[model samples]
Target: MKKLFFVGILAALFVGTTNVSAMTEADLRKKFDETVTINGNKYAVSDGDKKLADDYLAKYEVSSDDCDYIAKKIDEAKAILTAEGQEDLTKLSESTKTKLKKLVSDVSANTSVKGTVTSGSVVILNSDGSTFAEVTSLVKQTGTERSNIAIIAGVAFVITLVGACLVVKQVKNSNN
Candidate 1:
């Protein structure tokens, strides 16, 4: 009975310690969409210098540049999200827009403009002293209870082995 209990406990431990990758691509896609929409709106109205519409359009290229940078991040995240078999954008949260803006602002200030519109991928080169970083995904870690299961199972297995050793010794003595 004790042996069976220990085996059951060990089996449960292995089952409980499995690592599940929680950051699905679908979540990234939704975040990308939200970022594009929010940033696009901001870019359209950001006129650096007030003048004629054409003059504003010509001088207003800076906002477009910012928009393009945010767009590239969104596109990259979308591709990864799609390849991971996540097609739904509805799972993205409202807070994702705020998070993406902060990420873009941080990345943009440190990186230099790289590649033309003709390049397949928009590459942002890191400045001479700057490090390039991107916000990928936010995921929750495994719970403490799950981690404890492995320790409990390990102790149970050791106890079971000792019990089996004692039972074998008792049998040998009885037969002698």
Candidate 2:
């Protein structure tokens, strides 16, 4: 019974320590929202600018349907912006236009949206079909954890070496 309990505890510890990549749609949405909020706060925008950005960003709700919804939306936006002439949409700063165009280009490359967009407002694409936000976040966390483990291991090795040296010195002194 005691051996079974020990095995159970070891199993539980292994299970608890395993990395999990479980992410829900709501979690992805929150990450998107937090990113937008951070960017929004990072720069100063007028009410009108904020409203425009909000409206533009709101159009993208991540869908798992695997349809070409992103391409369609980009085309629609482009058509609307360039309908008459480029002059009319001059109010959209060159930087914003460049960013949006880059975003559209990125989204266009991915035929399927396996996971949600990250960092870039609404339509950023991760080439591998895995989520950029979640994957990067996990990678960073794992890197930190690995670094911590390495540091702990180094400290333990040093302590053990020092203790062994002390023991050896004590034996030599006793023999003398």
Candidate 3:
């Protein structure tokens, strides 16, 4: 009877742990979407302001490892523009800048679109309470950062179950 009871407890523990861990991945994805949307919106808005642009140009020092490569590209472009002279390139420069700004806005819109699609999927899943493989694939594309949360949660849950099992076993042995 005690062995049966132990088995039941362990089974329940395992199932419960897995379910909790699975939910955490969804939660992390939701949080990541929220963060990206907020930050991207702010960046887009700040980039539109002339004062902010001047401030950014004056104070911005590129610190990332990738910054040097980006800076080199910028320098090369500037050298080409300077060689061509501002008078000849003014219209071209304005058009290029406009296109770049539009591209940034489009990218920001894409992020919003992704978030909306994920939210819609969540709503549909909740209404039906069904776990479709397609939904899982969508979440997976959001990146491993979301998936890693689930892994961490699963590990925590297993550790907790093992601790509980040890306690239960000790209790049962003492009673025996």
Count the clashes in each prediction. Answer: 1, 0, 0
- Best of the candidates, lDDT: 2
Best by TM-score: 1
**TM-score of every candidate:** 0.28, 0.22, 0.22
Error of 2 at 84 (Å): 26
Off by over 4 Å in 3: 1-141
What is the C-alpha lDDT profile of model 1 across 19-112, one tens digit per residue? 1233244542332223212212211111111112123222222333444554455454334333333223323343543343334344345323
Candidate 3, residues 1-176: lDDT per residue as tens digits?
00111111111111111122234645423322221121112111111122322232233222333233333333343344344343322234554444333332332233211111232121111113342111111123545887899999999999999999999999999999
Ranking by TM-score: 1, 2, 3
Residues 37-94, candidate 2: write the lDDT tens digits.
1112221223332333333234333333323445344444434334423332324455
Alpha-carbon deviation at 119 in model 2, angstroms: 24
What overall lDDT, based on C-alpha atoms, would model 1 receive against the true structure?
A: 0.33
Between candidates 2 and 3, the one scoring higher on lDDT is: 2
Instruction: Report every candidate's CA lDDT.
Output: 0.33, 0.36, 0.31
Error of 2 at 47 (Å): 17
Which 10-residue span in candidate 3 carries the lowest summed lDDT?
1-10
